[model samples]
Target chain A: MPRYALLVEYDGAPFVGWQRQASGLSVQQVLEDAGASLNGGVPAPTMASGRTDAGVHAEGQVVQIDIALGLSPERLRDALNFHGRPHPVSVVKAAHAPAGWSARFSCTGRGYRYRILNRRARPALQAGRVWHVQGPLDAEVMHRAAQHLLGRHDFSAFRAAACQAKDALRTLDRLDVERQDDEILVRTEARSFLHHQVRNMVGTLVQVGLGRRPVEWPRQLLDGRDRTLAGQNAPAEGLTFLFARYPEGLDWR
Target chain B: MPRYALLVEYDGAPFVGWQRQASGLSVQQVLEDAGASLNGGVPAPTMASGRTDAGVHAEGQVVQIDIALGLSPERLRDALNFHGRPHPVSVVKAAHAPAGWSARFSCTGRGYRYRILNRRARPALQAGRVWHVQGPLDAEVMHRAAQHLLGRHDFSAFRAAACQAKDALRTLDRLDVERQDDEILVRTEARSFLHHQVRNMVGTLVQVGLGRRPVEWPRQLLDGRDRTLAGQNAPAEGLTFLFARYPEGLDWR
Candidate 1:
């Protein structure tokens, strides 16, 4: 069996999430079914670098799968995209990873972006893709507050109650906030994140942007390490999984 | 009767076009219905800065409507937006122009933008909002070619066969091409345009971008002044009516 890495992009509005669920459709099930049919009905399970919740989009999600039937990278990508039809999911790229390199285990870093439509008027173009904040948001203040979230810490304050991470400890490499015209973009990079962590952090920063909290609130929350003292999770629609980075020898493409 | 001016924005995927037609629904019909309902069942005819074809978006379209019942600018916008619920259309701003000024006649300049998804993968995020071009497009070449289209010309080569413009002569103020990441944006500004002029120009520029046509091809087409001498019209989905400028002291806000 040969293992391949796929860079997947999707609009999350139609999906239940990245994982297969008994309730509704998922990106994983669609790809696996496409692969199974393409491989003559042999079961093909895909392991993603991470899973995004319902209504969470992805620009560059990584997935690794071992197929019994070998196909060229271009043919495999085209076949999967062809079968995925009308569904908003797309396999943007496919490359052979090093043998035994798993998308999840071999990932070195992951990046996410959250888009905020900070304007009085509602979004006509990016209606469901952005979090529409009617009130003016101070992006500079939000950026100043977000800087305190950098480095390793026990991010229990920003962790979801249902998070399955064994420990609250994680290293956050970067958290940047910028105002692009009417959009407030928040970008974050880290080795890993607890469930709903990115959305939680953004939600907390939104408070600071609104002048409801001081600039040092996020830092204080990090120091407190108490989940009950944090802000609500930002809606999943605004979040996008940007990319997952792998080690040097993994043949990432 | 008091008239009001509206700065409109919309995703044009839903309606037939900006004008009412017996063939299908249009943005004008919906806006009229919404306005009629909002104004005690009285018909409110809206005169827009210009009409867009089906699937053509608008970011700053101007429209003027007269109603028997008087309403402040604030109430007018809120009421129109309220009645236009569930539709992608939005009245982003409302103001009162000079008493005799019309949305169409008062316009001094108009701007349009065309977006091309220049990538191998089809657009997952901007589906139906962009023209997906799988082949590589050289933005610099496109820009070089577009320079020839600026300043003034008889744009018959880029006009639609069914265009009703009195003359093909028009002055183009600006034509710009820029690449932003995987997207190619073409912006054009002019006093007015012939039917399908923007889309036709973009399609011709696309040929130049792909190296199928010379950089001076557009200038040659202008010299020929023949409709059949140019490339096909680009899809309406990619073009957006960006803005319509009016004269001073009319309360544009």
Candidate 2:
């Protein structure tokens, strides 16, 4: 069987998330269905770098699948896209992966972005693509506060109560907050994350943005490791999986 | 009565267009209703720089209204936005306009953008915001064709047969076409336009993009005055009225 790394893009609004479930549609189901259509009777289980939650969009999600088809990379890409028509999911790039290459374990970093629209009125076209926050946010103060939680820490405070990660401590490579016009964007990079970690941090940082919390509140929450100490979970709709990284020589095309 | 100029933004998915009609919802109707709520009476009639068609969005639509309210510019913006809550309309900015100022007459230029997703899959979240073109297009050729149609010309070939503009000749300040990833964007600027002119030009340019017509087809179409020579009208969903320009120091805020 030939292994291929697929660069994917999807609007996650109608999906139940990246993983398949009995209740609703999932990106995994869509890909596997297309895979089944492409390679008869061969169950092509797709694995991704991260299993994003429902309503989380992705412009550069990475996934890997094994198939017995002898089609070239270009033909496989065109065929998969042809079979996946009418679905919002798109395989933007397809290439043969080196043996033992996996999208999940081979990645060096994952980047996520959270969008916030700070305005008096609700969103129009950007309704579901951003978190609408009405009130003046002190971006400088929020940026200052976000820096305190940059390094390795026990992020239990920022992790969801239902998180299944056995370890709460992880290193955050970067967490930068910036504002553009009436919108604020938060960019975060890490090797892995506990469930709801990014959303929880955004929820807490928004409090700092609103002047409800001091600049050091984020560090305090991280030190305390208490989930109840954090602010409300930010809505899932505003988070986007930006990209997944791999080794330098790996072919992504 | 005090006259005010409003900077408006809206998602045009729900409205029939900018003009109020007997059949469907319109941006004019929504703004009037909001004004009526604030004015404690039937709202004063509203006027806009351009009356966009159904499913056409706007980011910097300009409108003017005369009312007796003694509200300041900031208060007027807040009040209108408050009244327009949950509606896809927003009053982004507002200011007192000279009594002689009219949204339609005082505008110097109008800008519009058409977004097309040139990929195999149907868009999910961006379903209504972009045209899904499931075939390859030569964007460079499209750009060349668009450049030829720039500057002043008789645009009768690109105007709809039902266009109400008595004079089909108009000055086109700019027409730019660019491609990013799987998306192609066409941006145009002019002082005014005939009905369906942008859509018609885009349709014809798409033919050039797909190699059905030569790169000079657009210029040829412009030289000819027959509307039947142009391509089909592109869908309205992908069109957006980007902005309207006024003379410097006009102080519309």
Candidate 3:
């Protein structure tokens, strides 16, 4: 069987996230179903770098699949996109990966971006693509506070109640907050994270941005290891899985 | 009557341009109806700086209206936004303007942006928000060619068949083309424009960008002063009305 890596992009508004479930449609199911059709109706399993929650978008998600089809990289991408019609899910690029490379295991880093539309009135031009934060928010404060969250730490306070990760310890690589006009973006990267960590951290930092909480709040919450200390969960719509960074030797087209 | 200047933002997908039409809804009609509801069923006449075509978006459109209702700037902006719901229109801000200031007549300049998604695959994140052009585009060539259309010139070659302007002569203040990643953005500014002028000019430049036409083609098209010499009129979805600049003394909130 030939293995191919797909660089995926999707608007997660209508999806149940990256993994397939009995309840609703997922990005994995859409790609696998399309892959099945392309492979003479044979079911082909697809694996993603990470599982995203419902209504979470992705700009550069990496997915690996094994199939018996004799299709080229470009043709397979086009076929999947054609069969995935009307679903907001799209395969941006496809490439052949080495025989033993797995999308998740080979990935050294994962990046995500959280967008907030900060203004007095609700967002109009960027309606679904951003989180609408009413009133003023100081991005500099949020950026300063976010630096405390870098490095190795136990993120049990930020983990979701339903998280299944066996360990809550993870190393965060990058966390930066920047503002442009009425939009504030929080970009983050890590080797891995427990479920709901990004949103919980962002929600907590937003409180700092609003001046309701001081800059020292995030570190205190981290030390306390209490979930109740965090702020809102931040909505799922504002989050996007940016890219999965692989090791240098592997080529990802 | 209280006169207010409004900074408006809207998604043009569901509108029949900014003017009221017999067959469908318009941004102007929605604002007038919302104003009427707040003014005890009395119609409020509203004027806009520029009338956008259907499916053309706006980030910072300007409008002026006279209403009999006694309301502050904040309240009026909130009321309009609240009543305009279930629609993709929003009044970003409202402010008290000079008694005789007209949104259309008192404007010093207008800016517009045209976006093109330059890639082999169709856009999933920006589906209806951009013009999807497959293959490569030389934005540098397009920028150089666009310079020929700037300054005061007879724009008959770019004007629409149904354009009602008395003369084809207009001064183009700015025109620039730039590319970022797989997107090409064309920004333009002038005191005003003839109907479909911007889109037509963009379509011709796209030809130059695709290497189908030479960089000097725009200059020849301009000298010909014939509409038939230009390329296809670019689609309405790619265009956005950015802003309308007024005189320095009038405060536009």
Candidate 4:
């Protein structure tokens, strides 16, 4: 059997996130159906790098699957896309994965982006894709505050109470906050993250942006490992899985 | 009566377009209802710079309305936005217009943007917001070809058969084409446009991009002035009304 790595993208609004469910559609179920259709009734199981929550989008989600049928990578990509037509999911790229390569363990880093429309008016087409906030925000102050939470640390303050991670310590490689016109985008990269980690960090940053918390609030939250010390979890809709890193020889492209 | 100018933005996906219709929702209908709600009972009639077709979006649509209410400019803007909630339309900016200011007559130039995703797979979240074209496109060739259609010319070849414009000649101020990754964006500016002019030009340029037509196709179409000589009108969904310009002293903001 040959394994292939796929770069997947989805709108997450229609489906119930990436994991398959019995009641609603999922990215996994859609991809499996596409693969089955292309393989003439043979279904394949697909594994993704991250299992995103409902209404959370993915621009460069990585997935891997094995198939016994023989198909060129280009043809397979086209067929999967064709079968997935009319659905808000797409396989943007596909390639043969190196032997024993996996979308999960082979990844070195994962990048995520959260978009916020910092303006008085609500969003239009970007309604569900971004968090609409009224009033002015001091991005410079927020950027300074975000730095205090970067690097290796116990992020329990930003972890959800329901998070099942056995360990709360994680290394955040990078955290950047920038403003583009009326929109503020937060970019982060980490080897791994606990459940609701990103959203919790954003919630704390939002408080700083709104002047409810001081500039050192993030550092203080990190120093305090209790989840009760953090702000509310930001909505999942504003979060997007941007891309995942893989070993050099993994053939991600 | 005091007249005010409104800078509006909207997502055209859910509506039948900018113009009001009895069959389905429209940006006009939504704004009108908001205006009625703000005015306590009187409905305010709004006039826009252009009446875009179905599925066409606008980021900087200019509209003007006359009202006898006591609300300040800022208050009027806030009130409209508050009432406009739950709708995809928004008044991004608002100001008191000059005594005789008009949205349609005071414009100097209008800018339009068309987004094309030239890639192997369809877009996920941006499905309806872009024109998905499979395979590679030569942006340099398309840009060179687009230059031939610039300047003042009779664009009857690019006009739709049902277009109501009496004169087919118009002056194009600027036309630029650029590619970012797998996406191609075309920006065009003109004082006024004939119906379907931008879409038709884009269709012809797409042919040039795909190598289906010669570099001189756009020029030939412009000189021919025969509607049958040009390519089909591109879909309305990919077109956006970027902004409208006015004389420096006459600009509201």
State which candidate has the highest TM-score: 3
In model 1, the fraction of reference contacts reproduced equals: 0.43
Place model 2 in a CAPRI quality band. Answer: acceptable
What tens digits encode model 4's per-residue C-alpha lDDT throughout A64-125?
A: 97766788777777888888777899888888988788888898889999988888767886
Query: Once model 4 is optimally superposed onto the true structure by TM-score, how far is the C-alpha of residue B164 displaced, in angstroms?
Result: 1.9
Clashing pairs in 4: none
Better of 2 and 4 by lDDT: 2
For each candidate, report what fraction of the true interface contacts it reproduces.
Answer: 0.43, 0.41, 0.54, 0.73
- Candidate 4, residue A92: the lDDT equals 85
Report clash pairs, candidate 1: none
> What ranges in model 3 sit over 4 Å off?
A249-253
- If candidate 2 were superposed on the true structure by all CA atoms, what would the RMSD be? 2.6
TM-score of chain B of 1: 0.97
Clashes of 4: 0
Error of 1 at A88 (Å): 0.7
Interface RMSD of each: 1.3, 2.7, 1.0, 1.2
- lDDT tens string, model 2, A67-176? 78777776777777777766788887788887788889888899999999998766777877899898988888888899899888889999988899889989999889
lDDT of 1 by residue, B144-208 (tens): 99998888789999999999999999999999999999899999999999999999999999999
- Interface DockQ of candidate 1: 0.61
Q: Write the per-residue lDDT of candidate 4 for residues B163-219, one digit (tens) a residue.
A: 998899899988889999878999999999998899999988999899999999899
Q: Please give the TM-score that candidate 1 achieves against the real structure.
A: 0.94
